[model samples]
Target chain A: MSGIELKNVTKRYKENKFEITALENVSVQVKAGEFVAIVGPSGSGKSTFLSIAGALLKPTEGSIMINNQNITDFDEKQLSSVRLNQIGFILQTANLIPYLTVLDQLLIVKKMQGTVTKEDKAFALELLKDLGLENKEKKYPNECSGGERQRVAIARSFMNDPDIILADEPTSSLDTDRGHEVVQQMAEQVKTRNKAAIMVTHDERMLSYCDRVYRIVDGKLSEEVRTQEV
Target chain B: MGLALKELLYSKGRFIMIGLIIVLISWLVFILSGLGTGLSTLSTGVLSEAEYSGIVLEEGSEFSLSKSSVNRSLTEKVSEQEGVTDTTPMSIFRNSVRKEGAEDAEDKITDIVLIGLEPDSFMEPNIIKGEAWSNSDENQVIADESLENDGYKIGDTVVLDNTDKELTIVGFTENKTLYHQSALYLPMENFQNLRPSSPDDADVEETVSGIVVQGTDVNLETFLEDEENVEYGTKEETIEGIPGYVAENATIMLMLWFLMIISAFILGVFFYVLTNQKTNQFGVLKAIGGSNGFIIRSVISQVFILSLVSILVGIGLTYLTVLALPESMPFYLESNMVIIYSLVLLAISVLSSLFSVAKITKIDPLTALGRAE
Candidate 1:
């Protein structure tokens, strides 16, 4: 089953003096177990596309189907529910709450929606164990190394068992070895959890781990047609 | 709620500094509020409790006991009007009195305002000691507690000056002092007899400085206005007549209210600065599917908790200061409606926190993605 579908989507921002076309006529699809990479440079509208797919930004035109329901029409509250229940996001930086312990960082998402159930706690522990942070749950963000913090952040992203993970630049701050390790962990989660993962990155070395790779130029997504058959 | 608590604990220095500012300003407002109430009591303690339906004074003149005078005959005429329950003649005169024995006996001869009253008038109800002043020539007088230092007990005699007649200190009263002068109550006749005169002139006839009347008799004012014999006033008019009482109170209260307004804005601004610094954290929470309502609730709850604690400290400090005042200070710590009013003032600071919380609602969630660096 496909986890996400973007059909003929567009996004624009109108400022007081000018209108910036951020994304135009973009369409993409990812099966439940696929690992997809979106490659682009700084001003290529890749961030805007990830923002729309993650439900953080409303599209200026066209539709988004997540888990078979068209989500472009969702109200603020409904969109928030979809994000809470279905989507996990990773940004360029770790974005760990500096005040929270590694464990509390994961629990905050579950607690905000409701109380944290025991099964949720177990799942969080399982994710943290797989990310090699099993013994570091009690440490504050500042006490952890940069690589450790990013791994904790990845654990947090999947805490809700989301069906889709949208990582803006998951390895931009990591060294070559740690960056490959992070990408390998994301790819493993996509296959093991039967969830689709889309990573927006400028690092071409990370492309081999993705099941499909596409490049965004100007405002549209394009790829070699032979790879789409996969 | 728990997350906010943890976050504040982690950044204890920032929140505590804000809390300390709240404490200092709230303490100031509390003390000023107490003093404003206390000073007003010292100025108008007697009038506030007299419970007269109306005070009568000269219509065209400023209402002051010293400036408004009605003859004894005029009060008798006013008593004839309908709804006129009781009319008591009063006279206020400047005089000096001294204890019969003291080290600085001449210095002990302090300037005082002699408020002369009929044997049992409406205005003299707060007599806390021996008895009210009587009309007999036995020279009996009632003094406020400021004279406590002089050891003038009941039956002790003090001289009102060169007159052969003497005043026996009969009682001590509380909170009856006029502005800057200890008030002494004496018989209206004694007051008239003590009025100053040229050395060779004849003695002034016995008459009261004013009349305190009860009931809603509207005709008495018109009758007094037309009558050439004396002046009369309604109670509101009489209260206005007290010297500098209204103007002084209005100025002080205005200052106190302005301070409260400034404190509210200061608190609102402080919270704004705090919220601005946390925008990235707010964005991170937003990216994780945290609703705007959740983040706003957390901010408002933090401020509400901080303000309530600050007000508690402020009230505690004010209470201790008020409790230490000596009885002879002529200040009153009122115990009625003012308690509820002070609570409302504290609540305004708590209510002011909502403005900062509103700013959180306008933050765009998309900023979480692009804004993260």
Candidate 2:
């Protein structure tokens, strides 16, 4: 309840006359201070589950509870508030706004919430330093390398200190070495800050950095046994 | 708001192109408006100078001062009517003038409108130099300042066309013209002697073209009902009734209004396309918990800023044109008219930006998350 919990979540799409189910009776829980990874092939409903957990998509036939509040029936405006205050999204391909520099990328989230302060600026600067992007603060997304862009995006996710973090394919556009480095930074932040994170990826090389891993196959979700140390 | 400004500053080249388009459209509108006013002024300058409350013309004269004929008896009758404080009988006839000794050739002749009025009537010229005529003498007239270009000076004699009588120019007034011809002020008697009497009447004392009346609270309808064969109209209405006046104004105004409407649509389409190009960006913002109002405010603020800056630049360009224009050219732009035009343009721009705002409201966050197929 302090993090994110899904109960019998199901998502279906109706196209003309045929009804297609993207997720069926999927239930998952991620506690505080936990790093979870969802791995599956394309079109396997991993993105659907992550979207529902992040409150971006509504479950067709179940409930989602974040911090003990039932969010399945929340209106769009209320859902937006929930997403802003409780959830953080790290989209695929390091989705930093093109015109914003690395530091502005993190500051913009605080600005959106109308809570920007001097302390917030210092915290953003400190987060960039922790991600090894201290000197890249003034560089735009186009100026930064792929790995640096991803690091700025990770820093942005922690800007608001939300209770839940949902990252979708955060390493899809990076090289293997840079991808592993980015995942390790995110793992360290999640553990050190006592926050819950759910990452959806298809790369098996990034799974060792996550404490728990799940695989979704054809609208069904199943947990995978961990064979390596975090 | 910050986001909008930052994006505009970063994308200076794109926004500058849009600003230049706005400038071109606004410049066209302002210049056309000035010309339209100038054309009306050219046709009605003398009549407007009369500043009379009402003008009475024969019913069938079609509001043309030259064609209107009124007897001296009717002028007296109008002065006795209720609310009629003063009445002046005047005549406007087209004639040519030349230096007294010059031959009657095309190059030596200048077309002029002979305006005959009482010596001290309200229609008397405001003499800027020399002295006004002291009496209704047959050999004295006041020439418009344009005649100075023809080498005429005070006390100089100019021969009237179709008559051997030569009139001495006693004074010069400001640029006063009618139907694009320079005006010459003369006494009513002198005006009558120069032209042939009406073919149907032999009495020269019964001749006059129209009556200009000044009074308080003069009702045009009541005046028309009291008189049998005369039409009464205010000065503005009379000017509008000039030949080709209504049609010319209507045509130019129609084109001006159409251009403004087209500019509004152009702005709408431009903003719409820009918004469409950023649909994916808006979607991502929405998915990240940005409210619809937030995105809408940003877009409207961008439009407001763009319109303000571009319209100011457009007005500045128009001012530059006014400064560069030649003095002889017929172009007049009033400040109030320009301000009204700018306000209407800004309103249209704000209205057009709503199209982009509505598009932002419909963007689904699901699409941005890659969850929807």
What is the lDDT, from 0 to 100, of the residue B342 in candidate 1? 58
Q: Pick out the ten consecutive residues of candidate 1 chain B with the lowest summed lDDT.
A: B329-338
Q: Cα lDDT for residue B341, model 2? A: 88
Per-residue lDDT of A211 in model 1 = 83
lDDT of 2 by residue, A126-173 (tens): 999999998899998899999998888888888889999889999988
For model 2, report DockQ. 0.44
Residue clash pairs of candidate 1: B54-B235, B55-B233, B55-B234, B55-B235, B56-B232, B56-B233, B57-B232, B57-B233, B63-B241, B64-B241
**Candidate 2: tens digits of C-alpha lDDT, residues B176-269:** 7778777889888778777766677777666777898899977556657877888876777778777877888899899999999999999999
lDDT of 2 at B120: 88
- Segments of candidate 2 deviating more than 4 angstroms: A114-123, A227-229, B48-53, B71-90, B106-108, B116-158, B164-176, B185-217, B220-224, B323-329, B371-373
Q: Which one is best on lDDT?
A: 2
Error of 1 at A47 (Å): 1.1
